[model samples]
Target chain A: MNVVIGIDIGGTKTKIGLVDEKGKCHIKTFFRTREFPDLDDYLDKIKSVSDELVENLDKKVTILGCGIGAPNASSKKGTIENASNLVWKGSVPILEKLKERMNIPMRIMNDASAAALGEMLFGGGKKMTDFIVITLGTGFGAGIVANGQLIDGYDGFAGELGHVDMTIGDGRLTGLGVRGGLEAYVSATGLKRTIMYMLSKYLVVSKFRGISYNDLHGEDITKAAEEGDIIAQRAFDYTAKMMAQALANFTAFTQPEAFILMGGLTNSGKWIMEPLESYFNEYLLEVYKGKVKLLESSMDGKTAAICGAAALIWENEKS
Target chain B: MNVVIGIDIGGTKTKIGLVDEKGKCHIKTFFRTREFPDLDDYLDKIKSVSDELVENLDKKVTILGCGIGAPNASSKKGTIENASNLVWKGSVPILEKLKERMNIPMRIMNDASAAALGEMLFGGGKKMTDFIVITLGTGFGAGIVANGQLIDGYDGFAGELGHVDMTIGDGRLTGLGVRGGLEAYVSATGLKRTIMYMLSKYLVVSKFRGISYNDLHGEDITKAAEEGDIIAQRAFDYTAKMMAQALANFTAFTQPEAFILMGGLTNSGKWIMEPLESYFNEYLLEVYKGKVKLLESSMDGKTAAICGAAALIWENEKS
Candidate 1:
């Protein structure tokens, strides 16, 4: 069996895994992504850890290449440009440096795009040629696939669905300082903001009454909603409605076969999915009613990112 | 010379022409589209007109095939589905019937999609592989090209940008009864409604004061705006702003190389284009500020439809 090394660089930690062609991870490890201030030092540590993992493998396998997924990574330029979350201050020549050190083929793309490719190959999107995978993490990110190929657009910035404006006036402000963007209403941070807004606007009694904004998390809201908290339920409803509306707009443009939901929001299960489905159907045009499917991603959250990175290599090879 | 027969099926009349490989229409003719209630009769009349045009061509040419562009046409199913503007009530097997009559290769696609193919091959989009063509006629229609290919999506209904909701409230109602859609604010009909809405909402005095809603047209507003009518100018401003916002949102999604404007709205020239360009810049994300170009279609409107319908066949042959 041939194997590829997959690296998923996150704000807090970097996950490294050896992924086989079958989309299975044989060994996985992690290191603090923000600990190293120097780019070369970080690459050295990553290479050492990957070498040790490869040495310990019980079965004989040919190491093909490496695939990396990171914030703001551009496959076209082979550099990570000004990723706000990462400690690296400027554009990092990741592909050039990695290839110089490992002497093998390597590729890089934004994490969201890599995840979409992973879903298409190994998860719920396996059978779908035209679908969008939306990652509802701290912020919203989208990977758009059309005609059985990922849409890289003109500048590899094509699938920025999170930045799409959703409101006309005084809507939630996004990190990008744009008011009423979809990311302001649909992400984990957006859900927390929605709950805060609901609490301030409505005098509904709930368990989250005393929770401070900084202390609140998406999991906390899920727990509270499960325990019959009205504020938390309202928060979920608002988020689902906004997401459904955005999805409806997206449907009219691309007419995808389905929309696959991933990341923290999907953890709420039926609480979010049910409302999302109903509102999406209501908001959709008559021509598209009951045609598009809403699906939950089959990839495991912990290893999904690593698998997605590795699948990039597999996808490139197949193409 | 090799030529192809192009047919553009409109609600009022059907335009048929003989087009050479270079996209030049040699001869053209038309007939009332609704005169025959039966689908076969309509197709037969179209065939007869096309045959007459082909026979009358002064140059010796090989008639390679036929291409049809109609509202709600499906290239995949070889049928024209329910078109609100057309007299046809259900799906019409146009490709089969036409192929049976002409006995060459035949293809059919929605009018907007055919127009997009035309633009890609011969109009403003001749050099652009990634761009969007917006048809601002009575209703809004869009054709998207990404990665050098048209996005037909899963059901051949992709690129429905007109129906994308632009507001969350009771904005202008669409012909489909959906309120606050992009079409409701940007199309010729939408512009009329905007002017009407502005007339009732604002006290700005202009030549439009005496015109009833039934008597108003897009050209009237254009003529008034050109003559320094504040009410007309405001209407143009409002329409351009909404269009710019929608285009910005679209940029975030597909990040096309340019956006080509066609039909009556583009006829306003700089009046619409200047404000549209400025507002589009203001609304676009920083990364995409000066990247996408806003262009006017070069194809003549009267013959553009025929050329677009013919281009579908030319495009298919090359692909």
Candidate 2:
């Protein structure tokens, strides 16, 4: 069985796993991302852990390829363009650096795009020829798969659905040189902003009050909604509506088979799912109304990225 | 050389042509669409015209295929769903009917889609893999080609760029369910409406006042614009701005090599092109900025449908 290393790099943690041609994952490893002073150090730590695992095995395994998923990884440039979370400031040549270190073929793509490929190759969208994978996390991200291929557009920035102006939300500052975008209202910050707006509007008090958005986390909001918190429910509802509108607009151009929602924030489950499903259907054109299935990511937490990044190698081999 | 019979059925006219493998169109024919009372009559007229053309040729030119481009033609369903402009009242099984009559394989697609295929096979996009063809004629229309193949979406309803919202003009009604679409502000009706608005706002003469908009045409507006009419020029500018915004949104999804503008309205040249080129650049995301080109379609007032529809047969042979 041809096996490949799948690495997922995130702001808080990093996940590494071995995925085979059958899309099955083997022993997995995790580490805090902050410990490494630089990207090279981080890569070295990953290599050391992998080498140890390979040595411990009863027989030497044949590693065919490597696939990495990072926040701003560019498939066209084979680089990780300045991710706000990572230590790297500018365009970091990830694929080339990894190739030099490891004597195997390596491919890198954006995490959301990797998730899309994972869904396409092994998960919910396996039977689908066209679909979109939306990551409802820190920022709403999208990976578009059209006609059985990922759309990288002209500069590999084709699936930037989050930045499409669904409605100019309260002007919020961001590094991408825009104050308001669809991401501002539907992402994690958008959820926090919604909570604050509802609290101000309804004059409500909450246990999660006074916590910075980053500290509160998506799960906390989910917990609040599950506990029947009116403000939290409202926040989820608002996000779902905006999300539906954005998806509806997107459907106008590329009608897909399904929209797979991923990331930590969508863990809110029914609070977000039910409303998004209802509104997305409501706004969809008659032809597309019942056609698109809304699905949860098959990969969860570290496993999601692991499977997604791993699937990249599986796909590269086939293509 | 393999050849196919290509037919474009429109509201008032039908265009028929014989297209060979090399995209060479021979012996073009045209007739009033209303001359036929039923589908059989239309097919008979096509057969007679086609028979007359091929009879004189020394080679026994067996028509290898038949391709049709019509409004609301569903490539997936092999039918032309009832178009409001056509005399037909319900879904017409055009492909199957034509195939049986000609004893040849047949395919049908929406006019814009056929135009996109035409551009891919024979027009400005002949040398390119991915491009969008926007037909600015009686209605706002588009055909998108990505990854060297036409994007039919899930239900064969992709590339509806004309239906995207217009930010500059009064929310105009469109044939599609959506209001304020690009069609409302950029097509023939859109141009007339803009002229009417200008007349009310700027023109004081009764000669250009209180006339039903249906009475005015794109030619009249073009003549006015050519004569340096301020209101007419502003109308063109407004149309260009709205179109540019729509194109910007489209580029967000599939970054094509260029946006090829076709159809009647595009004939206005600089009046439409200048604003569109400027605004498209201004609104584009940083990554796609200055990357996508805007070009005029070579198939103007010609058998674009014939060329594109013929391409279907030619494409099948090559594959």
Candidate 3:
């Protein structure tokens, strides 16, 4: 079995794992990503940890490939372009740096794209040829799979569905200067704003009071929703409607077999999924109605991204 | 060189032509399409005309391929499924029927998709691997190309850019029950409605003073705009802005190489093109600004659809 090492870099934490050809993951570990001031120091820690894992292995397994999943990691450019959340302000040659440390072939792709690869190889989309993987976390991200292949456009920058204009007319303003996008209404950060706006419009009581915007998480809102908080429920409802519209627009672009939901907010389960399903059907073109299916991601948290990166390496080996 | 016959079936007119591997077209002819009630009669005429063209060939053109472009044509199912404009009330086996008359293989696709393939292989997209073909006729239709291949989703029903929602809030009812779609505002029929809405809102005079809704065409308005009519200019400006927003959303999904404009309304040239270019740039993402080029279709009139159909056959042969 050809074993590949997978790494997932995130703003909060970084995860490393060793995966074999059968899609089994082992030797998983996590560390704080904010500790390092520069890329070299971060990579040194990665190499040291990987060295510790392989030192005592029986028969000394050879690493066939390495794949890293990070924000703005581009497959065509072979670099991680300036990520918004990351402290770095310029493109990072991660794949090139990793190549010198390990003599194996290495690849890099955006986290959402990697997640799509993971889903296609071993998760929910294993049996499907066309589908979309939507990550509704701090920000919304999408990966499009059509004709049994990940749609990496001319510059390997396809599947940017968060920016798809979901609202018409004087739409909600996007941070990118465009108005009314899926990200502005459906993302974790967007949901909090929705809740705040609803609070101002109507009187509401909460378990906690006087908190910073950065302190608000999707879990806190969902918890309040579970406790029969009307404001929280309304926030989720609006998000579901907005997300469904965006998905409907996506369906118009590519009639996917299903839409697989991932990331932190998907944990809300029925609160989001039920209404999304209803609104999706309501907004879908007649021919597409009752045809496309919806499902939640099988992989959870950082594991999905790590698994996806390993899958990319496995795919490269086979190809 | 393998020569193929292409047929473009429209509500009012049908075009037929012989096309070689090099995109050279000959034996072109056109006739009224609605004269026959049954498709079999139409096929009979096509057979006679095609037979006459191939009669005196030195070598038997036994390997002649055929490709048909029709409204609502499904590339995957090989049928024209209930086009309202056409008299046919059900799915028409366009490819199968054509194959029965010829010894060689044949295929069929929606006219817009055929146009996209034609543009990719023979027109503005000849040097492009990723581009979108937007057909500006009775209704706005788009065909998407990604990763150097046409994107036909699970049901072969992708690239429905026209139906993408551009309107937000109330007072908008879509054919799909969704509010504010690009087709709702930018189609040729939609343009006429826009003109009528402007007339009700502002004072205007026109040669089309007595023209009925059904009688109003994109050409009449194009001529009026050329003659320095304010109402006509306003209608084009409004439609162009709506189209630009749609294109911006398209770019978000797939950063295409270029957008190739085709069909009847694009014949208006600068009146439509100038406003469209400015609006597209206005709405484009900062990263993608000035990256996507817009070009007019190299194919003209009936030949555009014929060439598109032939291009499909040629592509299938090479594959």
Best by lDDT: 1
Sorted on lDDT, best first, the list reads 1, 3, 2
Ranking by TM-score: 1, 3, 2
Task: Tell me the deviation in Å of residue B260 in model 1.
Answer: 1.3
Tell me what TM-score chain B of candidate 2 gets against the true chain B: 0.92
Tens digits of per-residue lDDT for model 2, A39-152: 788778888877765666565588888888888778878888768788777888878877767888788888888889888887888888889999877777788888888877
Please provide, for model 1 over B189-303, each residue's C-alpha lDDT reduced to its tens digit, 9 standing for 90 to 100.
Answer: 8888888888888997788889998899888888998899988898899999999999999998878999988988888877789999999999998767789999888888888
Report the Cα lDDT for candidate 1.
0.87
Per-residue CA lDDT of model 2 for B151-216, tens digit only, reads: 888877776666665431236677765666678788887888888877768854433464577778
lDDT, candidate 1, residue A274? 90
Most accurate candidate by TM-score: 1
Tell me each candidate's RMSD, in Å, in order: 1.6, 3.1, 2.5
Candidate 3: CAPRI quality band: medium
Error of 2 at B256 (Å): 1.7
DockQ of 2: 0.46
lDDT of 1 by residue, A1-319 (tens): 7989999998888999999877899989999987887899999988999998898888887888899988778777888877767899677898999887898789888888889988988888888889998988888888888888888777777787888999875677788778888998999899999998999989979878898999998888999899999999989998899999999999988789999889998998877989999999999988788889998888888889898899889897776
- Taken over the whole model, the C-alpha lDDT of each candidate is 0.87, 0.78, 0.80
User: What RMSD does model 3 have?
Assistant: 2.5
